[model samples]
Target: MSEKIKIVLAEDEPSLALIIKESLETRNFEVIVTEDGDQAYNAYISEKPELLVLDVMMPKKDGFTVAEQIRKQDKRIPIIFLTAKSQTQDVVDGFKHGGNDYLKKPFSMEELIVRIHALLNRVENNQGSDDGLTHIGGYIFDYAKQSLTYDGNTEVLTYREAEVLKHLYSTKNEMVTRSHILKEIWGDDDFFNGRSLDVFITKLRKKLDKDKNVQIINSRGYGYKLIC
Candidate 1:
């Protein structure tokens, strides 16, 4: 049998942490639960988990600090932030600190499970491939490197941006529904996540705008189509 995927989860709430640990264990994931940010970081370094799920408000260092510290050495280990802070700036700060996804507090365990699977699947697929490269217009996208190169310019992409681009590229010239993209990437299609998706789409449009042939067309209320 394949080895179970390891996870480091940091949540200060005892009851919530226990519930999450039990749920993940039932799913055959090896979960390391910590109640403080300091212990969480230590566990992360020692366990070297396949994924990280951290609560924004934790004792002794907070999720942002932990994520920043981790990102300094590893940019590819998917980190998901869990917090009650839903402000736009807070979400942006989470991304700035190297978080791959964010889940607001009072979130469903099922949603968390789906997000975990989606992120792990993305990372595994890229690692399993011999060459994680894709061509779009005049640009070369390296999935493993999370970068886009064209001409003499190379732009590094955030984890969420890379996942969005990957999905668009895979469905090039075809309409990919917004709901599908949201569920696959953010694990939800709620108003906030939908708005977040729009922000990411705009960022991607600016990044690929140098090539006229590479266009991400919006299909009104339906979805988006990447024409390359």
Candidate 2:
């Protein structure tokens, strides 16, 4: 099954926040909640959730400011605004404030579900296959869902493992030096970092063990290569 859609919700109303949160969770959506606009922005910056739901009137910065800050850096991620204000001016301001969709308060959970699914479907339809699953031996990867399947007994890869695999694929037919992998991914090449890389290489090797022709060649004291 695909991973649950991750949502970051920022609402100041405790009761309403709980209701929305429970509704989302009940639908198997992973949600991160914050009561203030600033906290919401911070969570988004760090987590990079799939979607955002912000309340219009929030503590610390207000929904408009929060949405504006996020849009400044990322224009692709979908955003929705939730509010009690339903006037024409408020609706106009909400869009002007950078929300992809606006939901007036006293909305039903079912409506929220419909809106969330609509946005998710739009994003998915436009998104091409994930870069992570394009090639590996003769098997294709499913990056968004993190699975490797052929005949049966599919294996799931962790986020870090998927990232490492993607980077290695990008360097296919060329040696990816340990130094570069360290700096590019871990941003460190200390003793422990080297050990960590070794561990990752071991795990990746195990995953590709089924295919004998494909190889991740170790360059000994220098780098690694993804050989086809």
Candidate 3:
């Protein structure tokens, strides 16, 4: 028999955590629940869960801090952040700290389940070339490893970042619609997701800034064009 997918869930609210745990367990997921960031990190180390669902506002260390700490040790693990913070900077900070996905408060359980499955599928499939590498301007992007190396310094990218950058690189110098990217990578072109896409684009631009020749330009009201 196939083993159940294990998840580490860090939520400070007891009632919400219980509800989430029960809901996930019913869907064949084995969940380890922790109330604080410190506990969450400890659980991650001991249980070695396949995925993590973290609440941003925790007592001990905040979800972003925990994610940053974990990323130092394991960059491959998928992390999903659940939080009430919906500001643009908040969302950007979550991704910058290594979160693969972010779900704001008052979200449905169905959406959470779908996101969890999507992340697992991506991890299992391991998309990319046979060599898992690509070159853009003066940098080397290793899609398989989810990293970008420039001038001998490598920067690790989150799963979502790699996915977005890969798509942009594949269609370099050509305009790709915002709707297309939102639909393809995010599963929908809703307002929130659109904002998230913008955040990712900003991140990619910063990462590729070392090579002035490489730029992701906005075509306002249309899409983006990655010039390399």
RMSD (Cα, Å) of model 3: 2.6
Error of 1 at 45 (Å): 1.7
Write the number of the candidate with greater lDDT, choosing between 1 and 2: 1
Error of 2 at 77 (Å): 0.8
RMSD in Å for all candidates: 2.7, 16.7, 2.6
Residue 204 of model 2: what lDDT? 79
> Estimated TM-score per prediction?
0.84, 0.55, 0.86
Model 3 steric clash pairs: none
Residue pairs with colliding backbones in model 1 are none
**Which candidate gets the maximum lDDT versus the true structure?**
3
Cα lDDT tens digits, model 1, 1-228, are: 138989999999889999999999999999999999899999999998999999999999999999989977777788999999988778867876779888888989998998898888867766766256798999999876778999979998876687789889889999999999988777678887777778888999999999999999998777999999
Per-model lDDT = 0.87, 0.77, 0.88
- Pitting candidate 2 against candidate 3, the one with the higher lDDT is 3
Lowest lDDT sum, 10 consecutive residues, model 3, at: 123-132
| Model 2 lDDT per residue over 1-228, tens place | 158878999998889889999999999898999999999999999878999999989889898899889866765477888989866566546655556566878999998888777767756764764534476777677666556665566887653465567778879989989998876554446554566567668887888888887788898989999887
- Where does the lowest 10-residue lDDT sum fall in candidate 2? 184-193
- In order of lDDT, best first, we have 3, 1, 2
